[model samples]
Target: MKKISIIILLFSCFVYGQNKQLLYNFTDIPQSLLSNPGAEVNYKWHVGIPLLSHIHANAGASGTSVYDLFADNGIDFNEKLRRVVYSMNKNDFFTVNQQLEIFSGGFAIGPSYEKNKYLSFGLYQEMDLHLYFPKDYAVLAYEGNRDNIGRVFDLSDLNAKGELISVLHVGLTTKLNKKWTYGFRGKIYSSLLNFKSTNNKGSFVTQEGTNNFYYHTFDLDLAFQTSGFASLVDLENEGQNDWNGKAIKELRKRVLFGGNLGLGLDVGFTYHPKEQWTVTGSIQDLGFIHHTKDVETYTLKGEYTFEGVNPLFPNNGSGQTADEYWQEIEDTFDDLFELDTITKNYTSWRSPKLNGSVSYKYGKKVLKECNCTAEDGDYLNEVGLQIYAIGRPRRPQTAVTAFYYRRLFSFLSGKVTYTADTFSKTNIGLGISSHIGNVNFYIMADNLLEYQNLAKANYASVQLGFNYIFPATKK
Candidate 1:
């Protein structure tokens, strides 16, 4: 009974390629190369499950979990929300990313698999959204500036990024000798829509005034940029009532090669100094996109101060009335916030990620005298620690995972992980791969402890795929 329970616990699968600690260097799955281009795999050729080849979704909040505000602890809901907001700082953030493969395949080259090169190619669509916690903005909206006198709200706190894109990629890996293997992947990216608003500077403040009233000050500079959404704006301007099919048409035009495009490169290597020890490292998405079509940038700059609104009754005909006074105030604000719009080409760099791990193998699997299976030369168990980092606007996001991998049979294998990162202190993950005949099916998941009751989870992710692997045939 205890052994069965352990099996069930280690079988809930998940992947975080964005930091995919489970999938990195996990050589059994061909798609593992997405996380580490230089990954090691034993297949001579393979075909993916078309659209079902790979499916991944991840979302996490660093500030707090959902249960913190929605718990059934008999506390006031609003009070709970307030506590959550207060407990968090501006550096905290929420992020989400999802990917789906359209198609993928790979094949080995040369005389023999062990002494040659392998090539893999595929296409996938992905979307990502990232945002930092705006504590000052929340306070301003919740209590208004009236309650917090002389407080400054920094406009720079508003940092965010979002994008939807499709990537076409091809990779090649070669073994130079028994001790070294290297690989690299080339990618072309097509973006359907994207937006960024990370660079900003200014402050909003409410202070006691000299005119026997409160003074609201706005010394502001802000900018927002977007690409590939010009058609929607035109639809609204044209007053078109029917937007169903037309919207889809616009999307189709951009999702293909007609959209904003970019290039990326991924490279890595695997090394073994001793028979039982291995080390691997890789960098992914070192590239940028050019946004030239349907591009727009909006900027708000300059300064303005308001003591208060005034009611005016002019005795002279040249002066504004109470309503005109309001109009005059409106005009002042209009000039103060005169917006500048531009349509110019800009380059946006893809956020690059880093992965590295060191592992040692032991407990050789009991095998037949003559080696005939793929698992023959492999060990029964492995233990290792991996590190992951990704570049961000404000800083780099990082995590460390320690894992244990076991191969109970030639057809079934699994890995269990314990991770610590900005998202949570205690995150447990599991991944399983099964090979029956030439077909392979894999699934991985993490944070199962919190998954028991999702509201308590600050992070959640899952990855799964199917493929057909063929044995290497020597020339």
Candidate 2:
């Protein structure tokens, strides 16, 4: 559940990251990415069930800023194993951060309910488990006093099991007026995010290896919004819950408060000279939020220096035994260099975007166009073409502009009937939508690239949803 929730969150971010292609194409529909469920409205509710599968890999490099630190201080020196010792003296030792490339894949599938142009509500159960992860390492080696040509090691080769997490979400939205809308939602999540390495002691021998431990944690969420969608603040995982089942010598308890808030404005106007052509534009996700907070924890690594020993072994000559030497070494090391607990905290600030679109429709696909011959229902079909542009803040060169065309087939199934939009890039998708007697159903798929490309984080995704539209029939 937690895994699926995470995937949904990632998908939302990737799609609506900054009003690019999928959800918010600056099409006049107010969209919310933080909550899985949407709000209610007057138009047909767009219910979506989306399933996403992909593999994400780190493609950057680990630099030298960290290597220089390990060399300057023998404290974190990689004595025998060519790896630096961490957690020995937390506050003093330099912290190293690096990037890597690895094969990691997972999938998420669930139902989503949403009402378009009126109000929207949503709920979904999802899970995206990771079968593999990148191999990262921090090496510390010194040669001939000055010229230290460190040897690169692949730490990812160590054996580790896959992890599965899950999440559930529910949301609601309502329109206060023509220009103002409001929404709220709550989420519950749990992560079985635990794993162990295959090397056993060989991997756990040093700080670099010992750092491969896993833990399970759960989080919470609280959010609300007002029309015009000026800004929103999300509060998540404020603290840990009570756990009395585990039998540990020491059960320490800690509390934390964290999440992100956005502050911005969305202003757009549609221009339709012939009523058949509509153009819209808006700047989206213009503000930044902290995705994660810096964390500080203990990462200890060190060795024992023997003292009392036999004559052949040296230290205490033939008079002392191994126990005496071991005890002496332990006492000396403990007194000379004490252990330190580290606490780290950092924040991730994402980029914003600017988007716009021009769409042209050939017919009226509304309630007035009941051209269906069926005596029981109304169906409207129309053809549409749209040219859209999307740009990111940091990397403008990667900006993408696409042209889309959608063909509405029929509404005989009790709702809107439309096929997925096909872009000029030759990417094809399917769309199934319907709204009958206040019940709405919608499904849309994007990208649809090959399965192998999906793992590369370079493919398309599919979304299907169902929503019940309850208009304020009475006062």
lDDT of 1: 0.81
Encode model 1's per-residue lDDT on 1-475: one tens digit a residue. Answer: 5684233122111112266888888888889888877777767899899989899887567877777776899999789878877888888877768899989999988674354788999999888777777677777866888888899999898787778888999999887776788899999999888888889889899899987478889888888888877656675433354675676677767766878999999999888889788899999999988999889988888788888655455775556577887777788889768877888788878889999999998887554675544454678888999999998889999999999999878788999999999988798999998889989999999788888886778787888999998856433
Instruction: For model 2, state the Cα shift of residue 242 in Å.
Output: 12
Overall local distance difference test of candidate 2: 0.29
Best by the lDDT measure: 1
C-alpha lDDT score of every prediction, in listed order: 0.81, 0.29
Error of 1 at 399 (Å): 0.3
The regions of model 1 sitting more than 4 angstroms off are: 1-17, 112-115, 233-244, 309-328, 337-340, 368-376, 473-475
Report the alpha-carbon TM-score of model 1 versus the true structure. Answer: 0.88
Write candidate 2's Cα lDDT for 172-192 as tens digits: 444434333444433322222
Off by over 4 Å in 2: 1-273, 290-294, 297-346, 351-354, 364-425, 448-457, 470-475
TM-score of 2: 0.37
